[model samples]
Target: MARRIKVLQLHPDYNIKAHDFADLGEQIFRALPPARFETVNAFLRGRPTGDQPESRAERSIYFEFSDAQLKGMRIRAMWQLFRYCRSQRFDVVICNRFKPVNMMLMLNRWLKIPLCIGIAHGFGEYDRAYRRQQTARLVSPAWRFVGVSPAVRQYLLDCRCGFTERNTVAITNAIDIVQAEGLQLSRDEARSQLGLEPHVRLVGALGRLVPVKGHIHLIRAFAQIAGAHPDAQLAIIGAGREHDRLLREVELLGLQGRVHLLGFRENALRYVRAFDIWAMPSLAEGLGLALLEGMSGRLPVIASDVPAMLPLIQGAGGIAVAPADVEGLSRALDEYLSLSDEQLQMKGEQSYRYLTERHDIEVFRQQYLELIDSALSEVTL
Candidate 1:
């Protein structure tokens, strides 16, 4: 019998509630081939707050460290990772963040693992000079750096950030179409459940209430056009530190009734049908998975024209506005509101077609498998 490949996936955290990193990790975990691979998921931090639901895939190994230990957590995590690798003898170490990449590289100096893959989920991962320097120092021919978007891959090369053209590759983020479809709720029913009037034209945005998400800008933009379109309402979902501040802004703008701040719903994507249009005004984004989820629901999108988002929205029946520009966002919202019902339906159809053609989870899983296979072949040769 052929030897089964042993794989280990490293992550900073595995909070299922959070989007982006955790979502990507979960998708990969579910897609990894069980027949030919033995996989284990490991995290540097302990279990997240709130209920920790059991995952369907392999059980995770968390390296619980206290606050003081966290000060030098990277080093401690590195030592723990090295020990684990040594005992388990994993054929491939997939590092989900730069810190883990650094750790594996340092370990490779002695152990020489068969394959090492680093995944860059967003542009911010390598923004600092020290990070770039570390990447430059640790990068090797044996290692492959995967970017979640073309813009991200190009940014790494253009910025002269440690990653070379030969070593870097882009793989667009994807959504589980089946799961998203399953979560779908009819527009009227969804609106009714959320206490929103079915007659009102709703604009929806879902993400954490963090500053970088640009929720404040979205609210400001809605404030500019609320009076002009009194029938239109804005719904911002998800919870974070910015919740109270957002409430204050809503009150200040006298939009208490028009703008609804629906804090963190477990199945927020199901409410997509309630929205006439989806809005994402993030100041910075990796690939805007929420935008993809919105598209899956066949809703026209209005997103910031950042590098990470531009390619995803362009020519997909969506409009792109300058990040943090309230005026631009308001205008886009107004334009969408002006369109006839038929035009809106056509645009939504276009978005659905684009999503089905380009961002399927099956394609993402295959790409990852191919990359792994290619790396293994190189080592064998």
Candidate 2:
């Protein structure tokens, strides 16, 4: 077998154990044979916190360092990598995301022969501009870049960030559905496991509880639905600073009993199938991976009318409402709540059909493989 390229994936922290959208670099790199990508986590004041992973991937490592610590052992980690690159043995170096791109770029002066590539998963045009300008200064010596969405790719291209359109490809967000076998559990079974009543209409949202997720809007919309359907309950998975604020809003709206906050379920997709309606009202996203997972679980979604969600909702699978419009969101939920079980199943099936055809794991894997293969050829030149 041929030797595989070596990659280094960087991230700040593993939020809710998602390994972050930034960690998509390592996920794709792991799929390539004999190729090893180690995860390097940069914590603010100390080591990153979380339970250690039980997965088969032993190559992953998280480093917590202060400015003082960055000078000691962390310096050695970079020096060691530099020396390894100088051996002229590895095929390439993939520097994942851009938090410390400048440091990586500055230190690659030690690289003897291997090429450097970047994986950028920016969400919006403004953010892309802000990040790329910062990245150019630190300049990790990456010869190519990959993004997860066309919107992201366009953002880079518009800025003329020194990457040719051909060199900046779209690989998209992906997950291994097979790993979560019980993730596709039947609605009744999942509801039973969670002790959910059979009669309650559940409108569910999943993702980190960040402001960008627009959970506040979902809560506002659900408050209206709760007004109409007292038997309806809004359930959200994922935890963050926004939790208490969201709960406070629920109470202020007098929806403490009607709205249930289920924080960060490990099997998010499994719990999704139990939902009467899956809602994604994100203000922005590179692409909604959680929404993809929700669709795969046969859940009909009512999402925001952003570039990323338009394709998913335009098909028969779900509804798309104006962003940040509570009334529109409430109206969509009200209509969904009135749907018969058979009608809901049909919409869910439609979502499944569209997602399987356009956004399945195999499609994502091949796209990633092709990106790497093409980048290797360019780097060889």
Candidate 3:
């Protein structure tokens, strides 16, 4: 048999749970057939803490760099990473996020890896002049840049930072519908665990409580309709610095009891079944994974009218309201609250159908496999 192609998958940091970030790194490793590929996963800034599940790659390495070390020039980290790559003679390096991608681009000038693929998760990665100029200067034929969403790909193209039609592509993120559904608790159990009454109509959101997530807008929107829909309640799941301010907002709106801030639930996907309707009022997203997770639970969705989420919301037959527009969000909530039980269930079925048909995990895996094959084939030619 020919020698197995050695691949290195680099991520900036390790997640607390194996399930976060949609397990994309492991999914990529599994895409390459074991007989033909040897995979290694490297975390640039985190080390395993007792009993935490690690990457599923054949091997895993943690550099354990600090925040200050990773910032600025990152010369020391780059030198260490370069030495590691050279010693291992990796045939392909897949860099996830900006820091890993930037460092590899500079190092590959000497390391000369056969193939280097860089993935960008969201916007504004190359917004700074120096970042763009340096990227344009160092990019080579061996490098391929992937945007996690079509909108992100367009952002890269518009930046004119050496990412062109030939070197850039978009691969929309995906989730395993079956796996996600299997993880979900039954509606009654989920509600009970979440301290939600079974009879209450619930509007739910799952994300960090950051301004970019637009949670405040959702809270204000729900407040608008609270008096009209006495049976409906709003619940947001996740934690962030905005917790105290958001709690104050809740109090100011006189929605203290009606709105629930379910902070940072582990395996939040399991509780999605507790929602009557799922809402993601994010001001921006690189393909809202939470919205897809909600769909996997067969919940009807309401999402902001942003590029990353518009197609998913429209395809799923869900409502789309303008980002940060409390009035519009309020109207959208009222529309869902008015629906009959049969109508609501049908809406949810549409979301599930859209997810299974459009964002299937199998399709995502095949796309990555094909992209890798194409890159390797180009090298041979």
Candidate 4:
């Protein structure tokens, strides 16, 4: 009997909830042919405090670390990962983000893992020179780099990190439409659940409340036209360090009741139906996964005009405003508000159609499996 290909997916974070990396891991594990492959997940940090979601992977291992240990995390994590990798003897090591790629490369140098694959999820992951240099060191024929978007792939190439066309490929991110559809709530139901008024038009955004997410700009934009559209409300979901700052901003803008800060919802996408339109004003994004989820929920999108977002929103029943341009976002919101209910519904339908036709999760899964297969087939033990 043939042995199943043992694969280890290395993630930098301990928690596996809400984040895109967790979603990607789940999709890959669920889609892979179980008979031909066996998968395990190894996270570098200790388990998070929140309720852990049930994982689809065969097994999961966490390297529990203390706060003091995290101060010099790279060295500690590398030592722990080295011990783990030596014991597991995985045939393929898939590293998410640059740090994990570096860790895997360091291990590969000693262990010579048959196949090592790195995934670039966003622009910020490789923004630093140290990360680029580390990536350059991992550019052997046995290593393959997967970028979550073409923009990211191009960025890798432009960095001159020894990533050639043969070693790097772009695969757009995807959402689990089946699970998302199941979680869908009726507009009225969702609004009621969130304590929102039935008559109000809600503009929704979902992401970590971090600076790069540009929630501040979105708030500023909402403030610009809040008086003109008294029936409109802005709902920002997810929690981060910017939570208190954003609350202060909302109060300062005198948008106390109008802007709702719904923090870190486990099933945030379930409330998408409550939104009249989806707004993503991120300053930088690999690809707007929230925008995709909104589109899947049949909501028209309004996002920043960054390269990562443009490909998803342009000509896809959505509008793009320049990043940090409060006036532009205000105008876009006002225009969307002005549309008739029928027009808005038509736009929503178009978004759903576009998402279904192009960004289906099955397509993403198949592409990923193909990449994995290519890597395995090309490299010999």
**Per-residue lDDT of model 3, residues 144-218, tens digit only:** 988888998999999998999998999888887777877889999999999998998899999999999999999
**Position 239, candidate 3: lDDT:** 99
* Residue-by-residue lDDT tens digits, candidate 2, 1-381: 544455444444433243322235445545665443332222223332456442223354445434564453366656654554455344555555554444456566555334556666675432556555755554433466777777676666666656566567766676655543344667788778766777788888889988988989989988777767877888888999899999899889988767778787765666767787889999887777888777777779899878766776786358999888899999999998988889888888888777667765666767766666666666552
What's the true lDDT of residue 300 in model 3? 95
Q: How do the residues 1-381 of candidate 4 rate in per-residue lDDT, one tens digit apiece?
A: 899999999887875765343288778776689999888988776665656664567988878765566454567767787888889888888888876787777678887888888898887666688867876886677788888889989888788877888889998888877778888799999998888889888999999999999999999999999999999999988999999999999999999999999887767877889999999999999888888889988989999989877988985769999999999999999999989889999999999999888888899999989998888887775
- Global fold similarity of model 3 (TM-score): 0.98
Could you give candidate 1's per-residue lDDT for residues 110-225 as a string of tens digits? Answer: 66788888888777667788877777776776788888999888877875756887778888889888778777799998898888989998999999999999999999999999
lDDT of 4 at 22: 22
When superposed on Cα atoms, how far off is each prediction in RMSD? 2.3, 4.2, 1.2, 2.2
What CA RMSD would candidate 1 show? 2.3
Q: Which runs of model 1 end up more than 4 angstroms from their true locations?
A: 17-22, 48-51, 159-161
Each model's total of backbone clashes: 0, 3, 0, 1
Which pairs of residues have clashing backbones in candidate 4? Answer: 238-264
Name the candidate that leads on TM-score: 3
TM-score of 4: 0.94
Candidate order by lDDT, highest to lowest?
3, 4, 1, 2
* lDDT score, candidate 4, position 352: 91
Task: Please list the residue runs of candidate 4 whose C-alpha ends up more than 4 Å from where it truly belongs after superposition.
Answer: 18-22, 48-51, 67-76
The lDDT leader among the candidates is 3
